[model samples]
Target: MGIQINGKGLLIVLSGPSGAGKGTVCSALRQQAPELVYSVSATTRPPREGEVEGISYFFKTRKEFRRMIDQGELLEWARYVDNYYGTPRRFVEERLNEGKDVLLEIEVQGAKQVKECFPEAVFIFLLPPSMDELHARIKGRGTESEQVMTDRMQAAREELNQIHSYDYVVVNDEVARACHHIRSILVAEHHRRDRIFKEQPDWLEGI
Candidate 1:
């Protein structure tokens, strides 16, 4: 009989440039893998139209954000354009303790912090098929002004430069293919030799 395995949960970070379809890919991944838990970030920005308060993000006031930071309740916090964003440490830690695989869709900076804190966490960077395609995708959104788009494009370039730091880089040419690749990676990670060995110590008896 095959030996039963006890697998520990992993912290999976998905980061990519704007217009790379990171959100679409992540959504597909969640649908394909029910066990993967998506992290909800806390932000000081006013909730956008139809954005749920706690689902899409944990909308908070500037004062509340500062209070959370002061209490050391967040894993990583950053301020951008007069707004604050942070990952809630307690929520993630609690889920991890329950043996749930957590997925964090964040920026490269936040991904770097997660890697520093959890060296074993898996890092995946998504990329666009081409710069032209990236621009087209962003424009298709029809939500940003020229200046905001320019800023996003610039940020995307900077984020691309840090691709070497990630464990896996997937070019999201097609949503289905990209999601399949991500699922395969997670499945393969679960069957890693080190993890398998730890889970089935008796398998080493013949060695």
Candidate 2:
């Protein structure tokens, strides 16, 4: 029989440039691994149509969000488009303690902050096939002005330069392929030497 990893849960944080298909891959991954608990972020922005609180996001007011940050209640936070977005620390830690692997989808800036709090967490960078393809994908959305698209491309370029900081880089050429790679990473990490061999097994004591 194969030995199983112990009860400790993993922290999986996924980040990448805009239009790199992070959301699409994550959606497929959640479907593939429904046991992976999702870490809902807290945002000061008003909930959009059909978005539910707690599940979609823990909607908070700007004052309350800043208070959470000041009180050291958030794992990572960032101001984007004049709104504050942050990860709640207590919920994630509680889930982890309960042996639930938590998944976090964060922006590049906020992700950098998460690294400070969870250096051992699995940080995966999703890269697009090419800059041209990335730009084309962003444009295809048809939701942004030309200037906004240019700004997003520039930000994406800056984010790409920091891929070296991540533990693994998954090129999102195809959604299915990308999800496969990410799942493989999760499985492999669980069997890593440090994770699986934290203490000597009694079976090998006399060998």
Q: Candidate 2: where is the Cα deviation over 4 Å?
A: 1-4, 199-207
Please, what are the lDDT tens digits per residue for candidate 2 over residues 81-123? 9998889999899998887889999877878888998887899
TM-score for all models, in order of appearance: 0.83, 0.89
Candidate 1's residue-wise lDDT over 62-115, tens digit each? 889999989988877788898999998877888876778889888899888777
> What are the clashing pairs of model 1?
none
Model 1 weakest lDDT span, ten residues long: 1-10
Residue 89's C-alpha lDDT in candidate 1? Answer: 83
The CA-based lDDT of model 1 is what? Answer: 0.86
